[model samples]
Structure formats: structure tokens, C-alpha cells
Target: MSSPSSTLGGSKHAIKLTQGLVALFAFSCGAIVANLYYAQPITELISPSLHMSAGSAGLIVSLTQIGYALGLFFIVPLGDLLENRKLMITTALVSIASLAAASLAHSPGWFLAISLLIGFSSVAVQILIPLAAHLAPDHARGRIVGTIMSGLLLGILLSRPLSSLVADHFGWRFVFAAAAVLMALVTTVLALTIPRRQPEHQATYFELIGSLLHLVRTMPVLRHRALYQGLVFASFSLFWTAVPIELTRHYGLSQSAIALFALVGAIGATSAPVAGRLADAGHSVRATLVALSAATLAYTPALVHPAFGVYGLVVTGIVLDFAAQMNMVLGQREIYALHAASRGRLNALYMTSIFVGGALGSALASPLYERGGWTLVAGAALVFPLIACVHYWFVGRPHAHGRT
Candidate 1:
């Protein structure tokens, strides 16, 4: 492994990633990304506290996702044009402020605005992932990405339970306050350890943003991976958004019980590194199929027994999380291999589509649950991954084994 100080500001240095650095990158990604999900299991608590209507409560999650999508389009691409370490640290500071503000927000509108900021700043993780790719050798890039992504997926999976547990005991406001402190610690650690990389791209910010359209127009792999992941992510968002309501309303589970249920879902995060290894070993196409099929089929246990209790939903959560996360890592591995110089922009385009899908899913959750209940929500979720599977079957080719 190359020392961190050995490869500053020049692409000519051979960048060999160390395990300690990978762990730091993984931990930072996990801690930062956790900010987006802390509200998922506590929306019911937040709605009443802020006088938000039950119908519009989904906005808490959707607005955050919308902000994340906006940031992906406007901010993450700067990784190619700026000093990455400074940019990430600046973004982390903004996230800390947003999380702090969210805790103090008394009005629905105020809290919603803060939610958007939290999501916007959380795109630092996207920038960091590409940086990891830049540091890794070609042979180990997928595995390294997968290992770091495992931390990210763990953050996503664990945030729900952590927030639920916190909210149940100390109110939802405390959740954000605690998250602010955690973000501060993560930012300080990352600033101290993460190496600086000055991007060689010399374009102005406008040109960098403008080039996104051209990249989208030309990169079939980017479009295909984005489309597939977006559909599956929508399903992921829908199931998680509605399941909290289902558990609370029908099963009479308390916030802590819901927390426990969410913890079970964390088991699915183990698939991320496994998927990464598969992608590295020339099995991405088969893995993609497995991921899509697993996502579509994950809803079966719940659909077959809508009233069969939390165990069935637990099964659904684990399988869906496993499938969605696997597909995510697979997509990242492929896109990161596309154009080394354009990775930041490619990731920006790819992640923007995903959050758009997630925002739509979250926006639909309340209305779907209110009108048609779990059956309708589960049915809608099923259709998303199933559509991806159909599209992959007819349109996707087996050439994923080769580098694009």
C-alpha cells in the first residue's frame, strides 16, 4: 500500500490504496449517508410534532431525496473539477449545520427545508466513492468499491433502527441533534485522515455541468445501469416508507419494535461486498439478473400473507435490501470503469436518476397506504423491480463481462 502523503496532487504517482484508508473511507461514507435515513422510521412522530398533515408527511423523506437529486446534479460533479478532500469537508460542514437546524425546526415548512439541505450535503458520499475508485488499481477496484460500499449500505440499513430507537426514547428532535454531533465527529476524523486529490479537469463549472448532457447522450451503460437501479430503488423506498405505517397501524408495533424489525433488515447489507467480488470476477451480468429477480420476488412472502405478521415483512425487507444493494454496487462498479476522467459526472447522472425514483416512491407511500393499504403498496413495489427484470431480459446484453 502506498502512503497517503506519497500521492498528493498528481495523477502520475502510482496510487495504491491501503486497508486502513479503505476502512476510513467506508466509515466516513456510512456515517455521512446515515443522515438521509434517520427520519424514515420516525415520520409519524415528526408529523404530529410539526403539525404536518398525515397525508403530506411523506414529504419529509421525499423532499430530502429531491434535495439529494439536486445536489447530485449540481454538486457531486465538482469532484472532477475541484480539490476533492476540501470539497467533501466543506459539504460535511453544511450537513452538520443542516442536521442541527433540523433538530430545532418547529414548523413543518422549516423542518422540510432543513431536510432538503441534509440530503443535498450528503452527496459528499458520492464524491468519496469515485475518489476510492481513483485510488484503487484496476484489478482490485471492484472489490475496493464493494468493501467501501458495504459500509455505506450498513449506514443506510442501520439508520432506520437507530433513529427509531432514539426517537422512541428521546423524541425525534433528539435524533437529529445526535446525528449532528455524529457528523461533526465524522467530519473531523475524515479531514485528518483523508488524502487530497486535485482533479486534472480544467473546465469551468458551467462546462462541467453542461457536459453531463453529452455524457448521458453517449453512455449506454450509464443509462442502462441508472434505469435498472432507479426502478429497483423506487421499490426499495416504497417498501420501507410504507412498512413503518403498516407495523404501527396493523401490527400495533411500537417504535422500538419497528426498530428491532429494521435491525433484521441490516443483515441484507452483507450482500454488497459479495456483489462487488462477483462484479470483479466477471459475473456482473449474472449478478445483475439475480439482483433484479430477487427484488421482484422479495415481495412474495408479504403478498402471499399480508396479515401473516411481522416475520413475513422481515423476510421482504432482508431480501429487498440485499437485492437493491447488490444491484447498486454492481452498477457503480460498471460505471466507475467507464471513463476515469468523467466518473464524477457519470456518478452524478446515475445517482440523480436513483434519487428521483426514490423521491417518487416516498411521495407515493402515504397516499398508497391510506387509500389501498399494504396490499396496494406491496403490489406497487413488486411492479417496480419486475419492470426492471423485464427490461433487462429483453434489452440487456451479456457483454457486461467485458469492460465498457
Candidate 2:
């Protein structure tokens, strides 16, 4: 017979127990997120084996990003209508199945379909980000969000290099199969550790998604922050998509070496938690502007030193990911404050805008890099953030109202 005190003790233990689970939650999200990126670096390897062209190879990445954009808009809002834990698990299982299908794909069409499924299911990580914020104490929310974002950023950066090594050692098909197994193990851990909390919002799926337009119109803060996040992400997309291509084409470096160099800059992604800490301290809005502006400046140096672009490249990579992750942390912090009971809907708005920026980035990059090289691309990337700085320059300050 456990006394009330002992029952309280167990609950305390569970919250403390949540730290490791939170870290694993972050880790699992990162791993699942990596599924969409394997096609980017390995495009050369994938194209030849399937007898496709370079432009078509890039379409693989573009298609999945498009899928993610669609998911963030459609599937993610279901978190507001259903239990998050169940939604996460179901999506994870579907993601694993998709990976296996991709592994055995005989045509690019088959691979494309599986890639879309992978993107759709990978929103589990996005759901978990807001869920972590919801469960955490308001005081500690930033650090926790940061820690999880770090795991996610690492998974994104390391995905390319690790897949390269795996593809080099075995065939590319094995890469997909191996990822499927890891996602399955992740699904098990998540099912065991994550608590089931039904949504507080009662909106239908259609109602939830339709709210996006209304939110954009009525919510000044959401509109300002959403557009700010979009520009920041656009700058990020422009920088990353161009850097790897320039490194391989102009610098004449091996693919493996460039991948590792990318891994080096991944070191900067650890700033997520720090940004979160700042946000928790009531500095989220200011921090986002400063960090994104700094990243815009960092993009310039990378373009100038085409010869020693490695040094510039790694530095820019760090700033790009760090600032973007920080902005995400800050944006979500703002949204969480604004919508205490409707985080799923708030997140859908923010994420949908950010990913759309990415799709736009990948689309613009191939053309700019092909025609004018890094100078034009870098210049174009910097222009948006400057415009963001100008807009927010006037809106003047954060809103002091709440709807949650």
C-alpha cells in the first residue's frame, strides 16, 4: 500500500525520469528527421545506379520537402484532435514501413512515393517539440527545447555523412533498411516512455487547419513572427543548399571530405539550449532578431573566400543552423505563450511557414548556383533577412494578450 506521500514521490520520480526520456525523445525525433535528408548527399550515388540525371536527383530532395510542407499543413493539425502519443507512434510505424519500401524501390517513382510518406510521418519530431514545451515548467522550457533541438540539428547534419559512409560500405538500399530498424526501436521507446495526454482543443481536423488563415489574419504576433521566421529560414535555405554544391564543384574536394567538414560545423548546433534559456528569461523576440541578423552577416564571409571556403563554409554552417534553431525555439516560445491550450495549431502555422521557405530555398538555389555562382546566391539570401529586420523594426513590440 503506497501512502499519498509515496505516490507523490513516484510522480516526482517520473518527472525526473522524464529527463532521459526527453533526451531520447529528442534523439528519436532527430533520427526520424534524418530519413528525408539521405537522398541529398547521396544523389550522385543514387542517380548512377538508377540511371537518372543530376537535376532529377535534386528533385528527390525537392519532392520530400514538398511532402513535408503538405504534412505540416494537413497531418500535423490532427495532434489537436487526437492523443499525441498515439499519433506519434502510428506515424513512426508508418515511417518505418515507408523506409522499407524506399529500400526496395525499383524506379524513381516508387522511391518518390516512399519519400513522401517518410516526410509525412517525420512530423512526430515537430509534434514532440511543442509537446516538450507544454510538459516542461515555463521557467525551464527554453533549455529543454534547446536540448531537443540540438539532437534534431545533429541528426540533420550527420545524416548526410553517415549515409555516405553506409552507402560506401554497403549499398544505398541497406541505408534505408538500417534506418527502418532504428525507427522501429525508437517507436518502442517512445511508446513506453511518452505519456498519453488528450488534446485540450476540440476543433475538427478541417476546422483546425482552416484556423491557420484566420490566425494569420487576426493574430498580429503570429503573423509578424511567422513572416520573420520565414525570412530567417529562407536565408538558411539559401546558404546550406549552395555551400555543398560550391564545395564540390569549384574546390574540387571529395564528397566524403566535404561531408566531414559539414559534421565539424554541426558543432555549433549545440546552441539550441542556450537560445532556449534566453527565451525562458523573457528575451526571446530580441534574441531571434540578433541571432538571425548575425547569421546573415556570417553568410557574406563564406561567399568571399571561395578558395578557403572550408573555413568560411564551416563557420557559416554553424551560424546558419544555430540561428535557425534559435529562431525556431524563440518562435515556438512565443506561440506557446499565445496559445496555451492550442499548441498543435500554433505549431502547424509556424512549421508550415518555415518548411515552405525551405522548399522555396531548395528551388531557388539550384537555379542561382547553376547560373551565377555563390556571389549571387549569397547576396540573394541576405536580402530577405534585411527585409525582416526592416518590418519588425516598425511593429514595435510583442503583444501582451493571450487566447489560451
**Candidate achieving the largest lDDT:** 1
True-vs-predicted CA distance for residue 243, candidate 1, Å:
0.5
Clashing pairs in 2: 142-276
TM-score of model 1 vs. true structure: 0.96
Predictions in order: lDDT: 0.89, 0.74
Candidate 1, run of 10 with poorest lDDT = 1-10
- Which segments of candidate 1 are over 4 A away from where they belong? 1-15, 402-404
| Per-residue C-alpha lDDT of model 2 across residues 1-404, encoded as one tens digit per residue | 01111121234235552688678867986898888777666776777777777677667777777788788888787877787778888888888998889888878777777777788877877777766766676667668877888888788878877887787678788889999999999889888977665665666778877887887777777777778778887777667667768877888766677678768867767778888788778776678677667766767675676665677677777777777777777777777677565667778888888878876776677788888988788888888777777776666244512232
Pairs clashing within candidate 1:
none
The positional error of residue 55 in candidate 1, measured at the CA in angstroms, is 2.9
Report each candidate's C-alpha RMSD, comma-separated, in the order given.
2.6, 4.4
Error of 1 at 33 (Å): 0.8
Q: Write the per-residue lDDT of candidate 1 for residues 187-266, one digit (tens) a residue.
A: 99988877788877889999999999898888788888899999999999999989999999998999999999999998
- TM per candidate comes to 0.96, 0.91
